[model samples]
Target: MKILIPFYSTYGHVYKMAEAIAEGVEKVEGVNAELRRIEEAIPEETLKEIGAFEAQKDFAHIPECNLDDLKEADGIIIGTPTRFGNIAGQVQNFLDTTGSLWMEGALIGKVGSVFVSTASQHGGQETTIRNLHTTLLHHGMIIVGLPYSFAGQGTIDEISGGSPYGATTIAGSDGSRMPSENELEGARFQGEHVAKIVAKMTV
Candidate 1:
């Protein structure tokens, strides 16, 4: 099984979440996870929006990936840094371009999951996950999320990365907190669970 993990990261917090989720997917035998980034179109006012000094930084530019990677993926897990309780504009923009894929039902029956990073405890992680789910549902994809059996289920009040909705990470207000061991373990378990479901459905 091949799973595509595609996302956009602003502060690199979401990138870490994607790596942990990919680690989980790779744990399953015969499953492979590919990480890809979405490229942003150059804006006419890029320097004005980002400042000339900041535009020179590598992080200032978005990377590119082939859309065929998404088409060939048996499963897809998307991650993004939360923006006002929704996916980042770049990620949303990429999904919006999948209208042709949706028309062809290219993503139908594939397993899909969402992961997110938030700057605050109440920064709308769940809302962002739900919004991601809405896009997957439109493509007739199967959605998977962490179950209550995971070790972190209902255990941590500080950060509940495990959700029935999907996996997530809370980066804290200062962006210092990384995903806990339990959260990483739970994310891996979620990936394995989704892969198994996809295999069974394909059979």
Candidate 2:
């Protein structure tokens, strides 16, 4: 079974979580995980001016996701940083291109999940995941999320981003914070959980 992890990250925060999710998916024997980057919507000059150009280099080697990638996967995990309580425009742009897929029901019954990064602890993490879910539901996908059994999402000792909606990490206002171990663990658990479900469905 194959699972595609398609994501857009201005900084490397969401990318790190994507890697952790891939790791978890790989732990499920017979499951293959693919990481694909969403095309950048910003101009090169603008990306340089905002420092996103440099930060994006870490994931530049990843392949850009294509519609065929979506069609072939048994499951999909989307990772996007929040943009004012919603998905980033780049992610929106990518999803917007799926009209053909929706018309043909190409993604029907496939497992769909999401992960995210935000500038603050309460920065619309749940809303962003739910907003993404709307698109998945329209495509007739089976939605999966980070279940409460992950346990790390309930910690009160530190400020972290995670919920029943999805896995998330707080990037801090200045974008210096990387995903903590707990947040990454949540991502891994979600990935593995989705892979397990997909495996059974495929069988």
Candidate 3:
């Protein structure tokens, strides 16, 4: 089975979580995951101001995700940094172009999940995830989240960002903070769980 992880990141925090999710997907034998990014709509000047956009080269080679990638995946995971309590504009623009796919129900029955990052603790992480789920539901995709079986989802000891809605990270203002170990683990759990679901559905 194949899982597609399509994410949008400005300061690279979300990108790191995407890689963790892919790592989890690999833990499930026979399931492969690919990481792709939605095209950046941010102006060149604006990206330069974020700084990390140019410094992060780990995923520079990955192609921009398209509608076909969405159609072909047995499961899909989306990640994005929050923008005013919602998903990034670049990610939203990519989905906006998938009207034809929605018309044909190309994603129906496929599993979908979301992850997000924010600048502050209450920086709308939950609302951002919920907003994304609303779109996934419109595509008739089965929504999957990190259940409590992944202990990281319920952690309250160290400061972390994750819940039943999905995995999340706290990216400090000015893009200083990165995802904590627990948050990354949560992302991986979500990936493995989604792949497991796809495996069973296919069986």
Candidate 4:
């Protein structure tokens, strides 16, 4: 079984979470995890002006995902930084190209999950993930989330992000904060949980 993790990150927080999720997916026997990048929509000059060019280079070597990648995978986990309470434009652009898949029902019966990063504790993580679910539903996917069973999500010991909707991390306003260990653990759990579901369904 194959699980494809496609993500977009402006400052690497989402990328870190993606790596952790991939780790979890790989824990399942007979499952393979692949990390992919959503194509950037921002112009090179604009990215440089916004100081994100250099940070993005860290994961630039990861292969860019295409629609075929979505069709071929048994499960998919998406990661993106929240953009104004929703998925980033790059993620939107990538998902928008899946109309053909929807027409052919290519993704129907697949497992779909998402994770996100936001600039603050309440920066719309749940809403962002919920919106991503809306898209997956349109593709007829089986939605999976970071269920409450992940005990770390219920703790108030540290300011962290993890909801029943999905795993998330809070980036500082200036984008300095990375995903904490707790948030990454939630992401891993979600990934493993989704992979297990796909394994059963595919088998």
Candidate 5:
């Protein structure tokens, strides 16, 4: 099974989260993850505070997955950095362009999940994950999330990453908190969980 992981990252934190999620998805036998980044029309700084030196280089100018990837995948997982209690402009813009896919029912019945990173503890990570869920629901995709059974649920220090809605990372104030080992494991568990569910449903 092929899983498409499409995301947009500003400060590289979200990108690392995506990578961890992919690692999880690949852990399941017979599944592969396709990692794609949303292309911004105009290049932007990787972090607003970091200035030019930290600007993210533009990827190919495409939004989400190419139609071909969406058509081919058995599942999809999206990631984005939080922006004022919502998804980043780049991710939102990319999702907006999936109208044709929606009309064609290209994404119907596919398993989907969302992940996000925030600069603070209350930076709207849950809200952003829910927003991503709304878009996936509109496309008739099946949304999957982290189960409480995973190791990190409810633990004090280990509770910072992954959520019942999906996966997430708390990047701390400087956007420099590398995802902890627990958080990384949680992300991978989410990916593997979704992929396993998709496999069963498809079979």
Candidate 6:
């Protein structure tokens, strides 16, 4: 099965998590995975002035996601950094253009999963993921989440981001932090769970 991962990351944390998730999908035999990013909404001049553009350049090699990619995927995983308890505007804008897909139920019955990164532990990870879930559900996609079967979901010894909602990471206020191995484990589990489910459904 082919799984498409579409995401928007400002400081690379979400990208790292996406890589971990790709690794998990690869672990499952016969699952094909590809990474793509949403279109940038930020103006080039502003992005350069604020340093977010330079950071984006590091990931420029990744292809821009298009509606065709969404239409072609057997399974989809979305990753986005939180913006005030909501999905980033870039992700929102990308989804906004999928009206035709939603109208025809193009994504119906497909396995859809999400992962997120936030600036703080309570930086609206749940809300952001839930919002994405709401959108995917509208398209008639089956939602997949990072279940407690993953150790990171229940760990009391460390700060973590996994929940029944989805996998997550705390990127710190300045967006300087990368996802820890624990958080990446959560992302990996999310990927593997979605891959297995897609496998079963496709078979």
Cα RMSD of predicted structure 3: 1.1
Which candidate leads the pack in TM-score?
2
- For model 5, the local distance difference test gives 0.81
Candidate 1's residue-wise lDDT over 48-87, tens digit each? Answer: 4654234224444334646688899999988887889999
lDDT of 5 by residue, 1-203 (tens): 89888888766777777888889888888899888887654445444445522535443343446667777889999889899989989888878888999999999999989988888878998999998899999999998989998968566965486679877888888767867777777788888998899888878
Cα lDDT tens digits, model 6, 88-128, are 99999999999999988899999999999998999999999
Candidates' lDDT values, in order? 0.77, 0.96, 0.90, 0.94, 0.81, 0.90
Q: RMSD of each candidate? A: 3.5, 0.6, 1.1, 0.8, 2.7, 1.0
Query: Best-fitting candidate, measured by lDDT?
Result: 2
Give the backbone clash total of model 2: 0
Query: How many residue pairs collide in each prediction?
Result: 0, 0, 0, 0, 0, 0
Stretches > 4 Å off in candidate 4: none
Candidate 2 per-residue C-alpha lDDT over 1-203 given as tens digits, one digit per residue, 9 for 90 to 100: 99999999998999999999999999999999999999999999999998899999999999999999999999999999999999999999999999999999999999999999999998999999999999999999999999999999999999998999999999999999999999999999999999999999999
Distance (Å) between predicted and true CA of 33, model 1?
A: 0.7
Residue 200 miss distance in model 1 (angstroms): 1.9
List candidate 5 segments past 4 Å from native. Answer: 41-49, 52-64
Look at candidate 3 and give me any clashing residue pairs. Answer: none
How does each model score on TM-score?
Answer: 0.85, 0.99, 0.96, 0.98, 0.89, 0.97
Candidate 6: lDDT of 130?
A: 96
Model 1 clash tally? 0
Estimate the TM-score for candidate 2: 0.99
Candidate 6 contains a number of clashing pairs equal to: 0
Lowest lDDT sum, 10 consecutive residues, model 2, at 47-56
